[model samples]
Target: MIDHRRPVGPRTLAARAKAAVTLSASLRAAVSAGEVRRVVCLAPDPHARFAAVELGADFFVDTVLANGYGLCSYVFGWNPARQTVNAPAVDQFLGGYGDLVLRPDLATLAPLEPGVWQVVCDVEWPDGRPVPEAPRTALRERLADAEQLGLVPSVGIEQEATFTGADGAPLVPAGLDYSVAGLTPLRALLGDVHAAVDGLGLGAESARGEVHPGQYEIVLRHRDAVAACDDAMLLQAAVRRAAAARGVRAGYLAAEASGMGSSCHVHLSLSDPEGVPLTAGATPGEPSALFGHFIAGILRAAPDLTGIWAPTWNSYVRLRTAPFSPRSLRWGRDDRTAAVRLAGSGRSLRLEARFAGADAHPHLVVAALVGAGIAGVRERLPLPDEARVVGELARTPWEALTLLDSKPARAVLGDPVIDHQLAMLGEELTAGLDTVTAWQRARGDLRA
Candidate 1:
């Protein structure tokens, strides 16, 4: 929902500028003490670039952003194919990548440990030349837009992941949804994760086991849109590191061995500058007029936004086969099966987005959600009747790509985004066209 005129809210602009232009107190302390070995830049793809921390009179950023995972995906997934951390000559990768600069988001500076601090970085290019491929930049713009409209968007992102043995089996047994015994095996591991995020100043709100074996959901408390997305990214990294330390695998894969998918549901609400929920109706049990328009715009764009939700080839496979995945873009009051479920009533009203897989990018999801709703509000889009079940989500990458050209898609995501996404998906299809999967090997060998 990026408008042609990129509106900048005074409040969001100041907060963003503080992070971009000023050195944080923690960073200043490290720079002055020569304690920091490296300053890592966290990308949208969750990849990190560890560069030498220049301990001079003042802090400076010389890292370049180009041909990196920031704008492009890995050979297949969004992350590296191998588990590589700090390489021997990693500083070279942080060097020149054509021209774009990777500016450290000082506001996101947090201790990865003692001598290392991880931060989310935003891409900066020349004016009039927008890098639509920059996920962090896109998120900042979306938040600014929300603020300019005199609305405050609150978001809480809940992601489900699996802790499993090396053989790819769940650490605990299934059929123990929400049971303490079900989550007992990985208590220490998740506990470490909770502690790690706490060090980052974003503590975990709640944790629970799911019906899917080894699958557990970590709920992050709600915050402003930008901060909430940052929390989600950092939370995922903490979970992965915790799993590795415990000698178990942290699987955020959409589908697990048990045919259940891990979900990354976002609980979102829009309120006025005064902190009053605009989604609440004049009377109880009803929705505000603006809420209807918001939901309508989201429903209209859901078919196409599926490409962003399920970006990888395997992502859609899980949504199509997993037990708890949403069936359609249909929405209802407090409905779990619906893509966007309306939850709570009165001032507590919110939308629990149940469509995205565990691996979907948080910033992209929020941008599209807020942008589309704003469009509806601006254009006065009419609300449609709610069907228990309406249309199915895009079933494949090809389906998603085909729907990517729809009017609603362009309305929500501009042409540059659509084209970039199509290219990335096309790359995925080309990458796997000739490769044989293990499943194919097992099924086709010596058969017919």
Candidate 2:
């Protein structure tokens, strides 16, 4: 149970929430007729968590995010850098997240289960300003910028995660990567997840076994930028539900098992407002000038992009220790080792961002990319040479934050938002580095 008495500190910011977005009343009537049992307001928070507020059938609740019913997007207490089982609360609540109003985007609403419908909400302040910390809002801002440029982004995401049994071991005995027979042990579970995602209206293009035992990857079909993020988050929720139903646990740790860590790969392509694909040149085989600029933008922004793409301390560990994940910001034609892999041709052409861990927030990843792309186009930056390796990724969150101490970081992510992340992640890095770890507990003292 949530502690209702956790003080929000100092003065109570008095407020009232109004559902003013044009979610048609017929949808509310469905709730009245028992067609819907609950309405869930979902948004991504600073920490890669889905902050939700559940509502009764009435769908008009003024008490949420106010009057002792607020939610924290950054209150998990496992050293911020670490993912945990059942740790104590961090109690590091900041009012900067503030009292929020759920402005539900009706277009993104979809059924989560039998009677619970999920809506991707635009969280706002009591005074009606959009919260800068909201990940979805960040992505939306990028899309708006894209619109100004007469371009819109198309995004598809592929996610990989491993499932474990009660014994803390992988459910599958060994790696049976990619082969259909290897996926046999997981077919039923995968089917349940597929059905669940479909039922939630988030369709997957494909699913396959991965290099790790009990690991699987689901590739979601591409959609417009915002919807693609909404679908990405929905697929995550669906997979966790499927895992729970099957008596297993899903793990999205950055270094779940060394080189086999789960990753969230984002594929981005661009098209004009007239719906003409703009990533390829007038010629059938070459990339357009715009495509080159966008790739240049991503490469330019990548060092600063590390904190968003790889948010946690474990993320840096995976980047350093894991094989296959990109270490340098390099672009290549279909080369999997490159940080930005230029894939497909014509309508299928897109850039695949391979740096983000499963723990990274999807919205911010896209937002940062969009901003970088826009900056590139505005400045007419030239694309670098096609190579498998170039500039390196930050080896630690601290290092990444240090890199963000410049104008480029502020340019890619707005100043306020970039400052907010730097502060939050900085606190974690300081606290975590001060504390001793399990690895060092034996490695250093046991022999000493």
Candidate 3:
């Protein structure tokens, strides 16, 4: 496998400058042609979304400067809430007073409105080094590790979300599921969403009505790990923008009191440098050693990785045994109830991870998967018996936090990443603990 002679590392800053020059020319031409007026620069944060807008002319100049050098410190200062700056994060950002260079090839620049275009950028330190806490950087590091083992990963993501009307209620009443009548009401909206996603060069494989009322699932084709995660993020943005244009809202919360849960399922496969699938064995329906090792790694790390995959407080509510969400750490052939489902055979074999919620960060999720799988390979871990079914995964946020704080998680995901995530999520958990909910009020007010 691994071609030891091949080079590692991303495009240099010089190369990015050249690409930015070419892009600037195109942007100027589009502006002069009256095809664009405004440019939106976007960077996805842990929980909140960050964006900066500028006139087309101003954006062209800034783009060139950013690519040639870097963008300012405000980009990485804020926490997930966008309210306060995490002091440690600020220290990492050159003491909250420096710039961050954009990664050379990790950006999606496309038209979002008639006279405006949006650019999704992945970033690094000004010196062209990976930012330890950055999700994209985490995934990139894991991918590099896979490359060392001669393994290339392809990831396919399936995202399910619900639509709500202007009143913040389900767009349609309950009980439609996958019926034609259920889908007919939202056909126009779905068409626009698909069109917008396709226009941005994000491959949207298919979209369909889901089992829940006002819920829908969109499947994206497989791509190299980083690209797939990027596409997934963009897809979510596209859906929300498209829905807003139609006077509705698109929500990806894991669980809603009256509606079913939404999820983000990841399908992964390993291939060689030449693109030959490595998951299948000589015998039909059997798995190769590489596949077994990868699966073993995922199973071993599933508990520790749960917090990242199901980050929100509502995420645990979606992990019950009913309605197809997995409750156990088990693998099964064509079994939707299992955490890991084996689909296809031979060249088409892949593992589908059913644990992630739609609310999880795409980059973090991919990083965890790739990191764990690589760990499995490096350790030469053995696969568990196919017939064995493990008990339920962490069913609550506290359980997930305990697992995440363990040594195994730190070993799998470097200490920097684990520490940063724990700090961020720990804040959310603390805030939640201080609040009293309506459910508590209803159940304990008079009795207590």
Candidate 4:
């Protein structure tokens, strides 16, 4: 039951159309000037990056065709290993070999190679329908649902990653945990990253040293849910490019073999159409009924949504009992140990979701979070009492798979979308099971 009394915010349909048109014109001008030699288009998956390259001259005319019809199987051919999979017929029907439209948002375009400009694209079907399996589409659907409720959702993402120098050595050999000494060694790399992200128009709030050696975290200012996720993805890409330019590497892997894990923390809030906060109450440190219900929804849906938040096999490695990552389905005020932490007051009141790892897809994570919150509001779910400890979350990918296919996920994400996710994740799980890890080999050779 949406509150029909209020109107949609600035992100109305007409406004978006105008913005898109303006962006298209700008891209065409850049192409005509030969400022862009190669146009790199991309879309992201839960565990991989999908992309295609086009010559600049071809891009001008092809832009219309690509936006309307779509590129070839490039969107579907990519797998986690950076190799193409021989997708089944059913998969092909869904998205494996079909045309995928590339909508060029000027905001996401950034320089990569000397003459190459990369633009992050949203994948859609040939007829302009959003691909259900696409991460960006998932987030957009959830945002639309929130809008229908007369509420606007905003998100700020904090992502951490490890940095290695040209010699493949850790920038910091020991944990400093936010110490200035830890940041001093990596100033050059961090500086480059800041400049790159700023050039792309991603307003980076701050960059700081994290708990692990050779690790750093960058905070992006809050924005609408979809833009926030897009900024997060673009920020990650920018950091990587910046590091490479400085003769280093930036890894977003959840956990290294012998180092602290990296995480992608999401801070979410809801506001009314008039930009008034709906999350906080008049009293200090107290949340409104709407905020409480949203938290309740997230707790109930946490188990089922774990697969999206922690999508990879290595992702489970970071969900341990300690290390600042939440292992349980709990919520508390300013509590880092809980999966959801309440923070701020009045208009700034927001929920911090700490379950996601750096390796997870930003769009999918945002979708699961927002969708679950919407479900909570619809059901008028009750928030649990604040607690220091609670029941554990899904600990393994197999367990996450079971929870993802459960009734709760279907209730929120619909059958087709959940089914597609299950199929894709199932493939990754099966492949993982077939591989022999180093630990297995070492143990088996000595004992078995």
RMSD of 2: 7.9
Q: How badly does each model clash, as a count of residue pairs?
A: 0, 0, 1, 0
**Candidate 1, 1-448: lDDT as tens digits:** 1011111211244555565444455455555676766666655642221222222223333223222213222211232343222322222223343344455566666666766666666654533244565556666766677778876777888888888899888888675478886667677887787777676656567878887888887776777677677778777888888889888898887777536788778888787766667888887556788878777777777777887788777778778888768757777888777787888888778888887888777887788788788787777777666655556679888888788767777777676556656666665666678579888898998596
Model 3: how large is the Cα RMSD against the reference?
A: 5.4
- Residue 308 Cα positional deviation in candidate 1, in Å, after optimal superposition: 0.7
Model 3 residue runs over 4 Å out of place are 1-39, 48-80, 85-99, 104-107, 444-448
Output the better candidate (1/2) by lDDT.
2
* Higher-scoring candidate on lDDT, 1 or 4: 4
lDDT of 3 by residue, 371-437 (tens): 8988898888998888577545688888888888888888777888887777666666876787899
Order the candidates by TM-score, highest first — what do you get?
Answer: 4, 2, 3, 1
Q: Judging by TM-score, tell me the better candidate of 1 and 3.
A: 3
**Residue range 1-448, candidate 4, lDDT tens digits:** 1110111222432344455566556666666666656676666764634455554545444554344326664445445775554444225544545666766554455555555666667776667777776777777788788888987787888888789877766788887576886688787778888888776655667877878778888887887676677668778888898999877889898886443678889999988756677898768578788888888888888888788778787888888533888778889899887789998877778999999989888887888888999888988888888974545678888998898998998877766667767766777788789899988899999995
Off by over 4 Å in 1: 1-26, 33-38, 46-97, 126-130, 388-390
What would the TM-scores of all predictions be? 0.83, 0.86, 0.86, 0.88
The predictions' CA RMSDs to the true structure, in order, are: 6.9, 7.9, 5.4, 5.1
Candidate 1: residue pairs that collide: none
Q: Would you list the C-alpha lDDT of every candidate in the order shown?
A: 0.67, 0.72, 0.73, 0.73
Residue 39 alpha-carbon offset, candidate 2, angstroms: 0.6
Q: List, residue by residue over 1-448, the lDDT tens digit for candidate 2.
A: 1111111111110110112222334455666677777778787766666667788746333333232234443332223444421312223233343455667665566787777777777766566777775677787877888788888788888778888889878889787577788777778888887888777755557877887788888877787777777778878888899989999887777777666667878898887765678899886556799988988888888887788888877787679877668878898889888888889988888899988888788888889988998899999999888894557878878788888767898888787677667765776676678789878798987798
State the displacement of the C-alpha of residue 121, model 3, in Å, after optimal TM-score superposition.
Answer: 2.0
